[model samples]
Every structure is written in structure tokens, then in C-alpha cells.
Target: MDFLRWTLIFLVLALVSAALGFGGFAADFAYIGKILFFIFLVLFIVGLIFGRGRGRTL
Candidate 1:
């Protein structure tokens, strides 16, 4: 969740910076956001796989 939050924050910052014409900063922020998003995706997948094996009740 934190990764997703940071990914969104950086993505929004990237868009805003790009709109304001800060090309370099926007690229960096976008790169960071992309990486964080992937990390979140991988973690979510792993959690789903392992979590299903637990068979815990809600």
C-alpha cells in the first residue's frame, strides 16, 4: 500500500513537473514512479500466491 501511495505521489509529481516544463525532473520522477509501481505489482502477486495457501478466515 505504501508503495502504491508513493508511486501515485511520484506519478502526479511527474505529471505536474512535465506540465510546468521541468523535463529532467519529470523524467526522474516518472522513472521512480514506474519502478515503485512494478515493485508494488510484484509484491501484490507474491502476497496473493502465498496468502491463498494460508486458508485463514476473515
Candidate 2:
């Protein structure tokens, strides 16, 4: 969740920086956002895979 939040923050920053014509800062923010997004994806997938059937009534 935090990763996702930071990803969104960086992405928004990248958009804002680009709009303000700060090309270098925008690129760096975009890169960080991309990395955080991927990490969030991997973590989400791992959680889905390992978090099966915890409260089954068997």
C-alpha cells in the first residue's frame, strides 16, 4: 500500500514537473514511480499466491 502510494506520488510529481518544464526532474520522478509500481505489483502477486484459504470452514 505504501509502495503504491509513493508510486502515485512520484507519478503525480513527474506529471507536474513535466508540465512546469523541468525535464530532468520529471524523468527521475517517472523512473522512481515506475520502480515503485513494479515493486508493488510483485508484492501484490506474492500476497495473492501465499494468502489462500486461511479461514476455510473445513
Candidate 3:
């Protein structure tokens, strides 16, 4: 849920930046968006790993 919210916010920001013709700002926002995307991916993978591990009774 949090990831979805952040992703939406990032997309909005990217769109706004692009519309404003701020290439540097747009690039920065894009970089942030990429980072956030990776973070979300990592969180999802960790959750999956832990969830599966939980069922295995470590």
C-alpha cells in the first residue's frame, strides 16, 4: 500500500517535472523514482523470502 502511494507520487512528480522543461529536475526526480522503485522491489523480495521462511519453521 505504501509502495503504491509512493509510486503514484513519484509518477506525478516526474510528469510535472517533464512538463516544466526542467531537464535537471526531471532527471533528479527520475533518479529518485528509480531508487524508490528498487527499494520497493527489495522490500517485496524480502517479504517474500521471510514469508516463505516463516512457513518452513527456521
Candidate 4:
């Protein structure tokens, strides 16, 4: 969750920086955002696979 939020934040920052003509900063932010998003995706999938059937009590 936190990783996803930071990914989005960095993506937005990258877009804004690109719009403002800061090419180097934009590229760096975009790269970092992409890496974070992938990490989030992998973690989410792992959780889904390994964390099933534990939400209720008998």
C-alpha cells in the first residue's frame, strides 16, 4: 500500500517535472516510479496467492 502510494507520487512528480522541462529529474523519477510499481504488483500477487482462506473464524 505504501509502495503503491509512493509509486503514484513519484509518477506524478515525473510527469510534472517533464512538463516543466526538467528532463533529468523527470527520467530519474519515472524510473524509480516504475520500479516501485513493479514491486507493488509482485507483492500484491504473492499476497493474493498465499493469504487466502483466512478471513473468517469458526
Q: In lDDT terms, which candidate is top?
A: 1
In model 1, which regions exceed 4 Å deviation?
none
- For candidate 4, write residues 1-58 as lDDT tens digits: 9999999999999999999999999999999999999999999999998889578668
Kindly report which residue stretches of model 4 are placed more than 4 angstroms away from their true locations once superposed: 55-58
Model 3, span 1-58: residue lDDT tens: 5875787688788889999898888887778877888888899999888888565455
Cα misplacement distance, residue 55 of candidate 1 (Å)? 1.5
How do the predictions measure up, each by TM-score?
0.94, 0.91, 0.74, 0.90
**What TM-score number comes out for model 2?**
0.91
Across 1-58, the per-residue lDDT of candidate 2 in tens digits comes to 9999999999999999999999999999999999999999999999988888466677
Tell me the deviation in Å of residue 48 in model 4: 0.1
Task: Give the runs in model 2 whose Cα sits over 4 Å from its true position.
Answer: 56-58
Cα-based lDDT for every prediction: 0.98, 0.97, 0.81, 0.97
User: What is the model-wide C-alpha lDDT for candidate 4?
Assistant: 0.97
Better by lDDT, candidate 4 or 1? 1
Estimate the lDDT of model 3: 0.81
